[model samples]
Target: MDNGIGNWPTIHRVRHPDRIALIDAANGAELTFGQLDARTNALADALARKGIAQGDRVALVTLNSPQMLEVVLAVAKLGGVAVPINCRLQAPEVQYILGDCGARIVFSSPQTAPVVAAAVEGTDVSEIIEIPSGEQRAAGEASQSPYETLIAAGSTERVEADVAADDLAMLMYTSGTTGFPKGAMLTHANHHWNAINNLTAVEGIGPLDISLAAAPLFHIGALGIFSLPLLYVGGTTVVLEAFTPDAWLDAVATHRVSVAFAVPAMWAAIDATPAMGTTDLSSLRYGLCGGAPCPVVLIESLTRRGIRFAEGFGLTETAPIACVLDIEDTVRFAGSVGKPALHVDMMVADPQGEEVSRGEIGELLVRGPNVFIGYWNKPDATAEALRGGWFYTGDLATCDDDGYYRIVDRKKDMIVSGGENVYASEVEQVMHRHPAVGEVAVIGIPDEKWGESVTAVVAVKPGADVAEAELITWTREQIAHFKSPRAVYFVDALPRTATGKILKRDLRKRWSADGSAVQR
Candidate 1:
């Protein structure tokens, strides 16, 4: 197929016209591909009427719903950039994103109105379209709010924009290791290219196969690597609002879901669930596991269940897929992230930035067509990360002689605990807000159960006193539950380099040496 022939709207317009597109389990509503196209066209017309033009950024704060999918395609059709905000983000974090991206319109769920209102306050965004899910209608609509009224009113059909394949389609923010999140610019071609690569990796999907996409569509892993491929193959997608063991199993058996993608933590829950033991999972062939490393125990458990599970590694920069282990190679490359995808070049580089020898761990660098254009507005960060035409992924790994890559560590102090990413800087920021905290550094400690647990080393103000549990409790109240540090070390001072950067490696080493420690 021609690269220009892969624009989402064009692809949907031509192929799978009568096929099923979206189904809302919450409301028992379904939209066929033809109906989806019409609805998205109506939404595109609605967006254009609201002064949203090509290259405009529209922030979306909603859950995994049919409307979310519609708005995504609508944004592409209207030539606008869709910024899907993490629905769990707090007000301050949401504000930073809206202001940073210069979003003109924020379409959010009714539940998120308060935070969305605060985020876009005093901004250029004069409209907040609140989309109510199910049967609930949100209260406190301002006089200028035309979303509920207009969407209910007859939608005026408008001509779709001739969106070029190269037109920017989405702006996804990376889970920043330092400072605030940076927007990664991805074009329609990037989405199409990566989605195509993902499809080829799998043994083709058919209309008879149903895919359970429980992962949030906001993440590129779910959108680009999972959902879009299923759509391209004209397969059925069983969407879930959230991941629950019972819900997942029921969806699979109830919908006869044949394929799905899930993280390691979710698999563990499924294994432990009584429902999974009795429920029929024979419909599922296998799943693509990513976001975090899959443990040997979890892999064994899935294997025993006759499910073929594979691993892959990528960041938000590489359209979220640089390498994925082939299902055929799962036995030989059991713990490896496998080799790079076709049409991509991946290598391990040492500190000197030279390619490392086989079986040697080094920073992984990947060059591929799927890589993003650059960060939205941060030129320096973009240049540093994407130098010499290779995207320097801040992940450490080793490539075996068989060309399988195994991650040894992360170059940055980011922790993936329980499938939710916990950036050290974000946790440290919460610590800094405490009056008793003088300094702090957070690191990931290997855990047999949770994979990696968030551990924090804190230095209290000379005269003030703070307990470890107190700090943990404070952090829990401040941020999301999964992000809170499982343990906190009250120290006299934190290890720092000459230039005053906290040395997380030193802190990890110290904890290893001192066995007599409080286990918060």
Candidate 2:
């Protein structure tokens, strides 16, 4: 059996025992590669002792921390799958993921312990491991004691993983415009190839390189984009508990972060930060932007500051890296996701999966080892998404004359707010629960701060009236706040197509311009 990526820590430990593997930004605590390997071995043994063996599901729901990755690697070492839950999700949303994946153990932090507790109440979760947060212990909280005890009890002997290249390693949950979220099954080889693609796309990524894990690790953007790839390449990763413009700037300056990846919204925030001028960015050799269309202005702004900013595009199903723009071509081809990665094969194809002519809008399809294996336990979805060895990305794009690709539209009509994917249908499902809501269509309105703001265009029930604030608050109670509508507009009736389908495009067009919205 192939050792797979589970052996990364062990290999690096032998290769660079004294090298720093991780830096917890919360408190400047560092873990050497040797210590990291020993900890992962111990955690793996502890998990095996708890009845978690190969192919078992383990969940992690916590803020960004070095321990989060430690748990992921430990589970990987045991040939188990790690499910990282979005901390922003409410109990039901969290419960659905935990139950869907049938996770038996969960990792939580002091800040997110309550939500984790509520989410695992009726699930298969039998054990909860609280990761240290470097914060004062909350009332009734034993912050780092649980993990410390487990590590102490577990044997530190090396555990060779019994996994294959295509064995499922992670089940990443991503929602579509309709229905519940689907878990994308990523194999160990998929992640390794993605790391190679990133290393090849971004030149000079090696042991000397250090990256900041600023985005939430639950999202593939932060996990696969830079941090994991860096780890695969024996580089150091700095973990952040949360993202703030000040925190981001401080990480780069203090850690001498050589490479960083963040969404365009974050880049915009960094651009707007007053300390951008004073912060010592001399160590930042390269910056990558994705998760949304990057404005050329932002690229130019960063370039003007002497920071090379490149752009790329992909989805959770693609192991998150398919197309990439080299740092040299970032400003020249602004607004474009550059070309497909050196190892990835991409084509703009018609509905029939046939390639469309250049410059013609069509669905973007990608085929490569980096693509995910399938959706967890959903063969029908797996079949539909992966046909002819190409993952049909429901994104409208066109290949230009210069062989560049730009995303024209999100075919799923998904909303990306502040680097988070908010499915319209999931939010709409909650919004429809409101007694006053008759019909509603959720849309994303472009915002300078957040890449897009979730907006609701609703036609209330006849003779039933509700304040916008009331409806917004109602949705927040029922769903994650990030997915809730930032602005609610009242309409007499929702525009529809001949088939009675909601015309979301027209709603977007009507509200996207002039930012005109009705409060009631």
Candidate 3:
């Protein structure tokens, strides 16, 4: 009976029993509110039977699916922390997260089963529940149970736990700009309030509205902002396993999806699709683009088709959304991320944390009920980031006289490549492992497809010769492919300061001055 996310399905089920709540676009599968409530309850009982009690960690490693949402809700119902892993991560990266969180159970799919199996080898993960992907399990692999089997064995009786509002709900991992990824601890209240803020910002979101889940559910932006908010208001959410322009357009047309959330890169691909002009997107009232800045031309093109493309800014530490540019202001303030959400307070401050003058670029600070508590198991990082009750987002932005904010640069050495955050330090670490590399500096350069592409400027050791493509391949083998440098540039020596610190600004200038970066 607490005001947690676990109660949302029950509330909606009682209010609108037969109303459609979710639609899996991949196979035209639908789950009504009544069915959703019953299934989540059953899954909660199943998790409890598996000894997943309160405060336990339950990790999910799968693509977008109705079962993914069900698992998250089930974990919440049992007062267990839900940790959704990025499906795109390599085995080692997944292993680090699984080990760090000490997950008791991991729900994986056929696609990610091999990676999960390899990751949980020495970890604390005791159960691996595989969600069916239309593939038969190998003869020898009977240790893992199918997702459907667990649900079938569970009872529909409501299984409840003593969950408090301030209890931890989600442990979201963010790829840090420096060092390994950290899990941001988001409480039940944090996610609940975020959904409230989202409902207030986007108009006409109710049971009648149909939303498209195009963004990856593992990301806070997709789950916290897009799916959770819609589910809270009893709206229908259409889940897409993965994003493809043609598939996205087809879903919007088939489901008559009213709203959606996607990155600017996705919008560009949709616009560039050959069937875009012929597709009927009139059902879409508006869509949100974040993770990177939206091109003015892309906004104008979508506007011409009666689809308003709004933009937002936030981080995983702030439950993903802090500010949003409304649909009406899409053209008026083409580049701004717009004003803060209803219950959120934002400020532009200097390095000393004092407020900056209007129109001056400074670090963006946000404070609200939606802001997460801190990073899991990182007290020092939590203290450094959450100072004076405000989350210091290491992003440089300027606010206009009218209070619209425009992001100018990232204070952190991070690159937004195709909607994924690639930390320069993480990429540099991989490059350093290469035997032929002596010194390496990674920086983000302006790119057309991705907002910014990861480029590595390397200085090979004496008597060591390494090809650009070979170095790129080497880096990809060590980390996530998306984090690997798309282009490599060899230099005699990298520009450095007297303190022996590489000046990344100089590298960016040098790379731009001479257009000689070897493209992948």
Candidate 1 weakest lDDT stretch, 10 residues = 135-144
Deviating ranges (above 4 Å) for candidate 1: 1-10, 134-158, 204-208, 413-520
Q: TM-score per candidate, in order? A: 0.77, 0.80, 0.80
Question: What's the CA error at residue 255 for candidate 2, in Å?
Answer: 1.1
Q: Which residue pairs in candidate 3 collide?
A: none
Tens digit of per-residue lDDT, candidate 1, span 240-298: 77678898888888777777887665776687688877887777777778776665556
Clashes of 1: 0
Residue by residue across 1-520, what tens digits does model 2's lDDT show?
5466778888898998889999988778789999998998999999999999889999998889888898899999889999988887778988999999999999988788998999998899998988876563222233347877788888889877678888889998884324577999999998999999888885648889999999888888889988888778889999988888999999899999999988765786798789998999989988988776665656887899888878888888888998988888887776678888878999999999999988987899999999998888899999999999899988878899889997766676878999987767567656766878767889999899999999998888778999889999988988889999999998998875211236686787788887544422
lDDT of each: 0.73, 0.84, 0.83
lDDT of 3: 0.83
Model 3 ranges off by over 4 Å: 134-145, 413-520
In candidate 2, which residue pairs clash?
Answer: none
What's the best-to-worst order under lDDT?
Answer: 2, 3, 1
Runs in model 2 lying further than 4 Å from the true structure: 136-144, 175-178, 414-520
TM-score of decoy 2: 0.80
